[model samples]
Target: MARKSLFITAIVAVMVLGFAVSAYAIGPVYITWNAGGANAGTGGPHQDYRLTTEKCAVCHSVHAAAVSNAAAGEFGPDPIGAAETQLLLRSSVADACTYCHITTNVSGLQIYNGVASNYTTDDQYGHNGSTSAECADCHAVHGADTFKGFIAGKILKAQGNLVSNVSGGVQTEAAATLNTLVSGGTVFTAPAASDGDYQVTAFCTRCHKTFSDASETTITAGGYFEEWDGSVTFGSRSYKNHPLKAAEATFVASGANYSGRVAWADAYTCRSCHAAGNNRVSTSYGGPGGLVSWSFPHWTNGNAQFLVSGWGVSDANIGLGTSGANTGKPSGSHTVMDGAEDGVCLRCHTNGSSGPPNNATAGVNVTF
Candidate 1:
């Protein structure tokens, strides 16, 4: 009887684990964009494209694409003059992800540096790597599972023939080194199409944190290179990540805590809160004024608060977020999230300026 009971228990444990792993995440989890059999505007945010947690699985792994993987996502940029620059992405070597995520707020944000006149009709980004050179040619999302996510480092094609001849095929070598991000000299080499042995997370911290390597590899004026964590070992992203994770947030219901409370016309999507939500609004001079709707000061006085261990810095400079971190004041005075331990004050506000460390920092300093 004892042996039978033990066997039954073991089987039950396996079933439970499978359920956790296989069940669809109902909340702000990931939703992959699969073009396999999908049609445009068929499934996505606002009915733009069909969305499924499965599709997001293409680039990001299963439950793994949580707040912890901010680096895996694109670093949103706000190009000057362009409304997109106000808090949207301009452009990058990497393809824009908004194609399927489809929210007009980001889409409406001007990218291409006002070159809209050239491709005025539609967005210039997200062609699905179909051109002569595509996002995959120079970049990748689900890199060798070991490589973590996206092009965290530079890929050097040494083996495969750079130029493939029609008849006589030339096998070229493909290798990936850590690049300037982390491995100053370390090269994560890939022997074949599937061998991503030379990958490292440290390399990702470089651009993510807006700084160069400790050895000062590939420093540039355009990218945030100098602005890094104090320690070389911590790297740039690590620094930013720390402050962000350490930040706090309150998960208020807006009177509509979970169910029918939140508004449908008001604007909410899997991308909003599921993307760990943008913290910049909760932790900076400008509080949570989301693009979902025209609602300025979106956050509300939180009813629940939680302190995190990591420094909070979302993709782009967007910092930690509280679900309803509205600002009667700036993002500094977090009311319910962690009860005033809100670290967003560091973005702006300082001594004699406005909110502060207790609301302190070097980056943004508010005048009012």
Candidate 2:
């Protein structure tokens, strides 16, 4: 009996080892996002030092590529229905992302993860389809539109208070700002509330949520200053913005004429549809035209701007040398900005855990 038991144990061990090898060996699609992150508490921003799916082993299970098949949703012939929803590597979208990014205190790994929530408080603000979706569903690692895998889909805008200050020397400075705005863009024009402060967008209203004007600011200035044109360039921290801008046509490249206007001229008005790159390694890193966006101070209390690179959610950061710095674009334009794999990042890539020490320290100490 003892000898038979030993033989059985050996057989089981071999099978388990084989599965492990297969998981890492297969050529499966990659998905990245770790819950227990590498830079959990030692950070400038949680996204700055985090890593993503550019690497191979991040996804495939050499021991068992079964999960790969499962994660791929289906492999059908006609309609692509070879499997059920459960056939994919995950049940929920977050499951697949969390697979490589296993957000636990696992051994031999540096990670930090949060519990997957059944509910979303940020739901009312960020996105309706913005529930914890999978990283792969919304991303294409190679041959992605823009630079890193920017989703070529309907992009959302932020809805919040436009935080700005009035220059004292100017009379009816509010009215002056109102008269200066261009047509077709009027959050900069005054017709809403009249605080005359600059613009601030919130994720809660990324699409179109009626913002509660609890602390209302009347629209005093109504002009699209090229300086404040969030279309091409995001304005200063104290930029004046209105409640919402009608932007549902900015992501796609210009095949049609916008009456001489090009798409992607605005933040919210974007659409996406990318073709995969034929060659992955020799593919060009870019500049001036990949996926570019303004960083919202989501993580750092309006103090940091995440210069995202990948999709809206696939926040990644690989170590950069001079050559690799501007890998996304043909040339590089390094300003006071941050970059991510999937378009999620911090504003300042220079500084580290250094911040308004006292203020952050006090805030950190408070219980949630």
TM-score of each: 0.22, 0.24
Q: Say which candidate scores most in TM-score.
A: 2
Model 2 alpha-carbon miss at residue 233, Å: 26
TM-score of 1: 0.22
lDDT of 1 by residue, 1-368 (tens): 99999999999999999898778544333344333334322322222223442444333333332231234243322221212221122223232443322222332222112232212222112112332223333233332222322222323222222212111111111012123222333323323321222221222222223222222233222212223232223222222211111121222323533331111111011111112222222111122322321011111223111111111222212223333332222233232243233343332222222332233232223222
Off by over 4 Å in 1: 1-98, 103-139, 143-318, 323-368
lDDT of each: 0.26, 0.25
What is the Cα-based lDDT of residue 10 in candidate 2? 100
Which regions of candidate 2 deviate over 4 angstroms? 1-54, 61-63, 67-94, 100-113, 118-122, 125-143, 147-368
